[model samples]
Target: MDRLKTLMDWFDVRLGVREILRSNLQGYLLPRHVNIWYSLGAVLLALFTLQFLSGILLLVYYLPAADKAFVSVERIMNAVPYGWLIRTLHMVGSNIIVAVLLLHLLSVLFMGAYKKPRELTWLSGFGLFNLSLILCLTGYLLPWSQLSFWATTVATDAAGAVPWIGEGLVTFLRGSPSVGAGTLGRFFALHVVAFPLLFLGLVGFHLFCVRRAGISVPPFGPSARPAGVGTTFQHEVHRDGIPFFPNYTVKELAVVMFVLAGLVAITVFAPALFLPPDALEPADPFTTPDHIKPEWYFLWAYQTLKIFPSKLMGLAAQGGAMTLLALLPFLDRGEERRPFHRPLFLTLYGLGILLLLGLSIWGHRS
Candidate 1:
């Protein structure tokens, strides 16, 4: 008992136990105005943990080599008992994670939580989001399925449209003028090893900043909570919240457990899907799918490639679009965070999402 006390004391767990728990939550207690939006961050956090754990399980059964990747996935589906369940959970978990991250980002933007002290937190988060997107893209190709292989080819081919350096870029990405064995190996390395490390490092740094900044209250501030705002438990139980531990922390854990249960249930019942048998056949560089396209996230970029004319004009459009997206933090340089306040930014952001979705659909039809 004395030795345990010593360890706790050394870690400062006794003196700052409350703050330590609060450190895990990037928010203001007695948040003044709690809503469902506030819960998104917690949901996203849970999703990321789910993704990582499920991915690790899937990796044990996954074979990275081109010849074996499809076979390994098949084994997971048919032979490995709970392997299909784990693989499906990982797949669904990835989609859910991305969706939750987007929702969290939009909620922060709408609430103007990205202002002032929380800027670094927001910036690091956005960067991490972009990296996660890239990670998803790379991972999609690692399976070497018909959809995965062709999707990658079409996506990378679009990259080759850059004016002077386009050809070189394409060659580098595809490991030649075409997609083949080398492309699969490179993507597998990126998906399984490189991006995961990069993502974890960024996530750690982002969480640290959140801990330092605390959660940004809405622009209305703490005084805005009138007497009758009792829709959610957050507004009621945490209206004048206590320390994160034993209170919010307990609830958060329950929420995570619920999400985990759902994910596991899906994984066990549904499994990761495989495309048609013909699609599973070896990749044909010469042939393209009747409706060749990339994963949903890349649809917009792919569509952008289609709209622009070839040569200088097309190159300009494609390059400019990519540059704008990559430099969003720098481009969206307003101090304002609320959607109503940043009308122009919000409008453009929405339009951009729609434009991408529309283009994706249009590109496929053509």
Candidate 2:
């Protein structure tokens, strides 16, 4: 231990590793009022870390060819030691990450954490969110199961609904006219290479911004201060808040452990039970399933497209909705930060959540 500490001290002298850790973690002053909501970011980081590790292990066994992809997955589950556990972690972790991201986004929105100085942080987070979705989309096709194949077809086909660029986009995404070996190869390249790099980069930048700006204070608690105060929230936090290392870190660690336990329980018991038996079959282009739907995260948009008679209109609506969400920092320009203080915005937010929930349920039923 002394030798290890000496080596670390020698490295830290040249690399400033200790300083970086001190600034970002040990010495960081978080708001006293930061509750379970603030732990979402830590939980997300933990999930992404698990996903990255498990994905690497799975990649050792994954085959990208259309004919061999499904068979390779089966071999991994049945033949490779503990490969089933690793695969389950990757699959279930993807869904769990998405769920946690939604909760984090909602928490930020309700807290008005994106206001003023934190706009760039919010923008980086939005990028991370979109990248995660793309990662999920690209990875979905890697299994090359019947469900993945047809779902990819439906998703890519929807891109062709765009005005003039639709066909080109579809061709680019599938690497051919339809989903096939080329599509699997392209999606595999993207899932394992491109998206992961981008997600990691964005996550790094997001964390830097969070550390620099500090966590947003609660908008309702005793530590809450109005937005226009000459003194920034960061200053107030530093003055009266607790150091993150022992106080807040404990809570965040507990949350992460609980989430991991739940993930393990679900993986062990459920184990892709939600996936239909049809999904286990290899792709058959000649026959189409009776009901085709996207993953639950995207079901809202899929349902929205179905509601509109015109494909172009549906495309436009979906694009506009995403654009609006991405530009929320600008669109929701107001001095008020608390949800209770802003009834109209709060009501609109509630309605939007309900609408999305209703659409997801309806899409699943359909």
Q: What is the alpha-carbon lDDT for the whole of candidate 2?
A: 0.87
Among all candidates shown, the one with the greatest TM-score: 2
Best-matching candidate per lDDT: 2
Q: Which residue pairs show collisions in model 2?
A: none
Off by over 4 Å in 1: 1-30, 220-242, 250-287, 311-338, 341-346, 349-353, 360-366
lDDT (tens digit, per residue) of candidate 1 on 204-321: 8988786555555554553543223223322223445545545555666676677667666666664433234544555555666666566555665666656766644655775687
TM-score of each: 0.78, 0.95
For model 2, state the Cα shift of residue 66 in Å. 0.9
